[model samples]
Target: MDNAVRNRAWRMRRKPAGLVQQDDLELVTEAVRALAPGEVLLRLVHVSLDPGQQVYMQSTQELPGGTIWPGDVIRAWGVGEVVESRSDRFPVGSHARDHHGVAGVQEYAILPEAALILVDPEAAPLNAHLNILGMPGLTAHAGLSQIGCLQPGETVVVSGASGAVGAAAGQIARIRGCRVVGLAGGPEKCAHLTGELGFDAALDYRSGRLAADLTLACPDGIDVYFDNTGGEILDICLGQMARKGRIVFCGAIAAYGSGDSRGLTNYLRILTHQVRFEAFAYYDYEPHFASALAELAGWMQAGLLKHREDVAVGLENFVPVFHHLFTSGISGKLVLQVRDGVTR
Candidate 1:
């Protein structure tokens, strides 16, 4: 790794509305010099494009030197390998996770020890660390442990059953010995959830008449409802909660694009059902993230957990894979494969 190699990346050309579009991007290729000291050059393996990026594109200027400008490289967390390193903490052949907003998409990028989390192959797949064993798992764990206060034998219902974070929550609920029911968009996804993911029952939200379907699924009443989708779905879940039931709000994918939050007329259900609703934000539980990862790795190794990643090749495909998050159709984790680097 002697001669300097230039890298191409997708730079946000302008702020995006609803979803970040490719047209808002521009590619810039520049030769990066060889590392001097305490620096590691990484070849990005995978890039994560999450639905929350809409917020990043909107208000990046609020942070100190963190503004999302046209010339700035797109920032994201991804697993990469150190091809050349001047620091022992990040040695050659080492794999690390970088927090710098934009790094992947380029064939090569430079990273520092502080920006990485060195990983072992035995722990989990590189992508898994960025996915199920990473933020998605944390989201599920924090929501369940905190907001849901999930109890054994309680009937817990989760929306977006087949997507990455939602699917993870369902599995965790099952492990807790709770009767798990999922609400997803399609029949195929519903079938996969109940048949393979150990969900006791799954309702296809795409079929309409969700209220009736939910009744058939949760005959004992919903004890813990994890509402990932807002709007009418939340309205329905609110009306169906058992007395003293808990509600955890993990995400509002249902309201992201339209920019219109829901107004529920079912406020009376809270008093009648004695329901407790808690909004969940994963960043609030970052201190316990280590414990969450430790448990996730053990579960994965013991074959008690499973994960799926939807990969998009090249930097150009990050937008499309990301759009799947808002779509009611796509399931599993969405990731961008910048280059071949590592697996479990």
Candidate 2:
């Protein structure tokens, strides 16, 4: 352990413009420092690429400086193994999922023991902790149970339905006896939603027939709308809400990179339909994590829940792979494989 290890990390090169570009991030290598008390050095195995990270980069409300500047290590969620540890909480050889600020696009990281969520490699594959059994899965549970107030036999439409959170939400709603319909970008993802995920129907938003397709799919009108993309798609769904319907504002990926902040035009429908709208964040339901995890795991093991991962290899490819999330058509969860030997 006397030799210093070279740690490679991706840092913001400049503030991103419209969509995240390849040059927006640069890979930098540095020698690892000695771990202090209560510190653990991790070898990152998998990293999650979420649309919310784009909003984090552009948001000025949360950061002290009002901007994520150059040379800053981009924040993300990563699953890694503790190669070295000085704390009993995160002993050496333990697998863990790191918290937001401590985890990033890096090959290795030195994080405090308190920031790690100890994971059992035997429970499920390591990558599953980043997908259906992780943040996105918890997000789906919180939105539906706490906010959406979903009822059996209701018609539910999930925007970005092929993405991680949306996919989980759709399947969970189906398990709750709701008629689940998903709206994805392409036909392939739409097909996967209906054929593989047991959704009642799937709509391709890119088909230019969203309104007609939605009407045909939900003849009774949508009782619950799990909105992942908030833009024109939201407007379309808003106009189709049933009386006393509920809307879960999970994300606004449509407006993340773009500077457009236009208000919803069809918002008056909420008042007319007596609709209830609630915004959800997974952290709010931390107390219920164990129950949610158990239920999702049981469903997964019973073959009732299914998920997919679009994995990109190597830390050097992090920037472009992240950019692919917004532009390229990807189904299910988007993950980056920083190191080898991690299971699916």
Candidate 3:
């Protein structure tokens, strides 16, 4: 372990106004400081790019204020290989990641022992830990089973269905015997939802026929609506919810870019339909993570659940790739390869 080793990370340069621009962040290089007795030196392999993390770069109504300040490293969830370790929990050459702490957008990280979670590279692709086997999959499971109270034979609708959490939620609903319908932005994503991920039906929200298309897909009304995009799509789902239905509020990607938080006029349907509208935060269900991961892994191994990742190589591509989330530039879980030539 050498303190002379250099680390590269993306640091916030300015508070982004609407969408995060390239100029808002700066690529910084510094010497990797020596690890303490209970710390680990990680060569970050893949960094998970999520829509919610973008809000930390700027303020939004949901978050109220920005959590990250200028000059701070952009935080994300990521998997890394322990190249040097002063802790027994994380040995040299072991793979680990953190969903609970700041796994920044960097090529190398010096993290505390408690902040790391060990992952098996042989169990699944290393990147899988950042997606289906990680937060996105766990979020989907907890939302559907614990929050949504999803039942077999019920009709479940997922908005932003091609994205990470949405994709997992739709498949998990299907695995649990629900008739799953997905809504996405384009025809290609819609097709991938139904044809690849096994969603029962898919509708393009960009077609300007969302209401009619959704109505046709869920003739009996949606029993559980996994809402990832919380704008007009949410309002449409609100009006079409079945009696005693549930709405799992996982994300608000629709408002993230535009900053136009269109209020749901059909919110009154919550009372009329006796619906349960609840927001999901994965930390609330942390106690169940091990079991959830095991189940998701089994599903993946058994060919029941499938996950996709849009991996962009090099740390330099982080800014443009991160912007892709809102523009639908990539499909599935977005990941940035911070280090090159590390075989998966």
Whole-model lDDT per candidate: 0.78, 0.85, 0.89
Candidate 3 clash pair list: none
Q: Point out where model 1 deviates above 4 Å.
A: 1-3, 33-39, 59-70, 99-112, 340-344
TM-score of each: 0.88, 0.93, 0.95
- State which candidate has the highest lDDT: 3
Considering every candidate listed, which one attains the maximal TM-score?
3
Candidate 2: clashing residue pairs, number: 0
lDDT of 3 at 167: 94
Candidate 3 lDDT over 1-344, as tens digits, reads 45978999999998898888899899989989888899998888999998987777886343432367788888888798898999999999899998674788998888898878899898889999989999899999999989999889999999989999999999999999999999988889988998999999999999988899888988899999999999999999999999999999988999986878988999899999999999978878888988998999999999999999988999988888888898888888999988677645
lDDT for model 3, on a 0 to 1 scale?
A: 0.89
Q: How far out, in Å, is residue 222 in model 3?
A: 0.8
Model 2 worst lDDT window (10 residues): 59-68
